[model samples]
Target: MIRFDRVTFTYDGCARPALRDVELTVDEGELCLVAGRTGVGKSTLLGAVNGLVPHFTGGHLQGEVSVDGLATHTLPPQELAHVVGRVGQDPLSGFVTDTVEEELAYTMEQLAIEPKVMRKRVEETLDLLGIADLRHRALRTLSGGQQQRVAIGSVLTAHPRVLVLDEPTSALDPTAAEEVLAAVTRLVHDLGTTVLVAEHRMERVLQYADRLVHVGDDGRVREGSPAALMRDCDVAPPVVRLGRLAGWDPLPLSVRDARRAARALRDRLGDAAPDEPPATGGEAALTARRVRVTYGDTVAVRDVDVVLESGHVTALMGRNGSGKSSLLWALQGSGSRRSGTVSVQGRDPGDVPARVARGLVGLVPQTASDLLYLERVEQECAQADAESGAAPGTCRGLLDALAPGVPADRHPRDLSEGQQLALVLAVQLTSAPGVVLLDEPTRGLDYHAKEAFALLVRRLAAEGRAVVVATHDVEFVARAADRVTVMAEGEVVADGATADIVVSSPAFAPQVAKVLAPGRWLTVEQVDRALAGAAAGEPA
Candidate 1:
């Protein structure tokens, strides 16, 4: 259904070709997952399907890309709207309607479908994506994950033959991500829709993918089955990594397969207990008492009381719309708080100036690009250094450590989602705030990038800074976080050690923990260490 014939595309002002001599084909009714490192042209490849590359993005194209036998080189995006539907990384930027129901119906209206058919499709899509409860909510009022579901539903309502999704589950919680993926699989299985999705979180989609299209660093693409490609792919899920570590032939792609192969390894473990996270003993870096955040009649956070300790990493986790973002914003002293008292270093951040707040607490919000305004990356880094009284190149150094190879002259807006996140993190960390808050920081990061970011978070905590990351990436939480705080319906539901909380919950457990059940293992590194110790005839 989709074909790329020796297609090569290069953006204006860049000598390196984003895609070079890419020849690929996607059969009808197949689900193809595009995998690659951050800023490695996964999005560029997806954009080519509907003529968004050379036509709208003003890039040079060689060769041709076609969908349903129609050449995209000759047809514009508008001309192929009936056959192709796309959902981008940032859902809010693509929204045109105010309410959830309206957004879902807008595409069908544009396609000139019958009103009855549009209404039916709208209801089906709402149910399919499990967004029936959000139909009447305003788009701006919904959480990021909710907005993402709405964005996908809007495109699905059009019933396009080929669905192109960019990070479709990036913003969703574990259960919600499963629901969205399930819906897409149904489309492929029952309705014969062709799907091409580029996602950073491979764990969620790898099991469902019929084919894997991996984009390498040299602008080359490799295509194979998931099990065949994951064996040696640099970017892979936790389960696949665990399979490789255990030397299991035909690397497992799902938790079930990994668990089945782990019986002998579990025997070898033989009651070796995983090391517990070190207990936090530092003084309180920030304290919140009776914090409440409301939007009109809806209460986002309700009288929440919590304490953040210096030299610790706390992961704030829960289902989507569970008040994680709202609570983080309230604590940062920038987002709306109907009634609350936040104390950072014995000073109320909300009462102080923005400059003072930066010293007290630094926040990398869900929309990291919103924090960037400068024309160039180097300028933003320099400004951050000057404003924070830090040495020049401090922010740039941090960016290099977190996600390397970002061009100095590139526009912050033009960077990929993961690169934008790294830049925002570098900008915020330059202030040397006592407390740091990151909301969905791993949205666009691949496995390797996430490993670097996890180390950076640990380094920040080691420097006597308290860090709180509000995220849905369970795998990341397992690797980076020392403590876990689960929220539900605007209230803290569970708060404790990371292993205890994540290992017990089925919805939030990482792949390794699921495979090594009956043990409190949270990450592959932990298991690796235990096995190594056992091999050396020492206590694991």
Candidate 2:
């Protein structure tokens, strides 16, 4: 149903082609997953399938690309809208209407379908994606995950045969991610709709993929079965790594298979679970008492009291609308706090100048690129230095440490989502604030980038800086966060050490923990250490 013949695409001034000599095919009703690290042109490849690459993005193209017997070169995106449905990384970017229902139906209206048919499709899609409750809500009011589902439903309503999704589950909680993936599975199996997805979170979608299309860092493509591609890939799920570490003959992609395969390994390391990461040890770096925030009639955050200690990393986790983002904003003193007192280093951040407040407490929002407006990375770093009154290379140094090898001359907008996040984080860290709050910091990051980011978070905590991250990545929280704080419906429902919180909550447990249940092993690294010590005949 989809074919790419020697396709090569290059941007206006880029030295190398974004995608070079790509040749692949996706049969009908197949779910082909595009796997690669950030900045590896996975998005560019997806755009080519729907004719958005050279047409909408204004890039140079070579060779042929066709979907459903329609050549994208001849049929522009508008002409191919009936056959292709594309959902981007940011759902809000493609929104054309105010409410979910309207957005879902607008595409059919543009395609000039019958009103009755459009309405029927809209209703079916709402139910299909389990988003009927959000039909009346304005797009802006919905949480990030809700917006993602609505974005997907809006495209699905068109009833296109080919669905192209980029980072569909990046911002979603575990439950929401499962729902979206299940819906996609139904589309592929029940409806014969073909899906071409590009995602960095392999653990969420790998099991659903029928085939794997890997784009390497050198602009090359390799297509194979999921197991064959994943065994040696630089980026892999924790289960795959666990298999490799345990010397399993074949890696297990899902938790069920991993658990079944882990019986023998479990007996070898009998009940020797490692201790959880140490808690923060310094004095309280920030404190919030009776914090409350409201939007019109909606109470987003309600009387939440919290303390963040220096030299610790706290992960704020919950459902999409659980007020994680709002609480973080209010604590940073950037957003409105209806009735609360937030003290950073014995003073309220809102009392200081905006420039001074940033130095006291820095924030990297969910959309990390919003903090960047400069033309180049160098300009952004220079501006950060000026704003923070730090050394000239302070921010650049932080960027290199967090994500190495980002070109200073490149535009911040031109960077990949992961690189943009790293740049924003670097800009925030230059201020040398006592506390750092990052919302969804690892959104588009691959395994390697996430590892680098986790190390950076640990380094900051060790340097006596309080760190807080609001994210949905359970693996990330297990690896990086010292403490876990779970919120629900505008209140702090659970707060404790990471292991205690994640292990008890089924929704938040990482893959390793799920495999080794009734035990406290949270990560593959912990298991590996235990085994190594056991091999050396030492008590684990």
Candidate 3:
């Protein structure tokens, strides 16, 4: 259904090709997962399917890319709209309408489909992706995850033969991610749709993928079965990593397969478990009393009271539209707070100037790119250093640590989603604030990038800075967080130690924790350490 014949694409200013000599084919009704490291041309490859590469993006193309035997170079995106539907990383950028229902129907209206058929497909898509409640909500009022589902629904309503999704589940919570993936699988299985998805969170989609197209650092692409490629794939889910760690044959791609293979390994380290770290017991870095945020008649946060310690990492988790972003914005003191008091270091950040608030609490919002306005990466870094009164190269240093090797001269807009996120995080961290808040920081980051970011979060806490990350990446929370706070319907539902909060919930548990059930393991690293200690005859 889709074919890339010796396709090589290079952006206007880049010295090297983003994708070079990529020959690949996707059979009809196949779910092909495109996997790679951050900024390694995964999006570039996906954009080529519908003529967005050389045509719209102004890049040089060497060979041909075709969908349904029609060359993309000959047919523009508008002409290919009937056969190919594309959803980008940032969903809000593609939205044209004001409400969820209108956005979903806009595509069909453009395609000039029958009104009755369009209405039927719109309703089916709303139910398929589980967004029936959001049909009447304003696009701007919805949460990031909700907007993402709407974006996908808008495309799915068109009923294109080939669906190309870029990080389709990046903004979704665990259950929402499952629902979206299940819907995509159904499209491939029941409806014979050809789907190509490029995602950073492979744990959610790897099990359902029929083929894996891995884009390596050298701009080359390799295609194979999930199990065949996972054996040596650098970017992999925790389940695959765990299978490699245990030397399991045909590395398990799902939690069930890993759990079935883990019985003997579980016996080897009998009664051995990870040691729980003691609480930080540090002074309160920030205190919020009676915080409330509302939008018209909708209350986003309702009289929430919480304390952030001086040296700790807190993971704020919830489903889509659960007020995680609203609460984070309120705590940062920049966003709207209908009624509340936020105290940071004995001062109310809400009453202070924006500059003062930065020193008190720095925030990397859900749309991290909104914070970046400079032309080049180095310029942004330099400006961040000057604005925060930090030493030279401080922001750039942080960027290198978070996501290394980003070109200094590249435009911030030109950088990949993960790189853009890292740049914004670096800009925020340069202020050296006592408290840091990151909303969906790992949205575009791969497994290695997430590990590096988790380390950075730990380093920030170690430096006596309190950090709160609002995210749906359970694997990241399992590795990075000391405390977990789960919110639902604009209220705090559960808050406790990381192990206590995540392990008990099926929707939020990490892959390792699910595989080694009856054992309170939260990450593959913990299991690795416990097994090594047991091998050394050390105390449990």
Off by over 4 Å in 3: 116-149
Off by over 4 Å in 2: 389-392
TM-score of 1: 0.96
TM, every model: 0.96, 0.97, 0.96
lDDT of 3 by residue, 400-421 (tens): 9888889999999999999999
- Regions of candidate 1 where Cα sits further than 4 Å from its true position: 116-120, 123-137, 141-146
Clashing pairs in 2: none
TM-score of 3: 0.96
lDDT of each: 0.91, 0.89, 0.90
Candidate 2 Cα RMSD (Å)? 1.6
lDDT by residue for model 2 over 1-540, one digit each (tens)? 999999989987788888989999999999999998878889889989899888887879999999999999887898988899999888988899999999999998988999999989989998888889888999998877788888888878878899999999998899888877888898899999999999998999998899999998877899989989888987899999999999887788889889989999899989676767775558999999999999998999999998999999999999989999999989888888899899987788878787777877888898887888989999999998998789799999988877777888888998888889889988987876889999899998888888888998999999999999999999999899899999999999999889889987789999999998878888899898999998998876
The alpha-carbon deviation from the true structure for residue 178 of candidate 2, after best TM-score superposition, in angstroms, is: 1.1
What is the alpha-carbon lDDT of model 2 when measured against the actual structure? 0.89
Q: Rank candidates, TM-score, best first.
A: 2, 1, 3
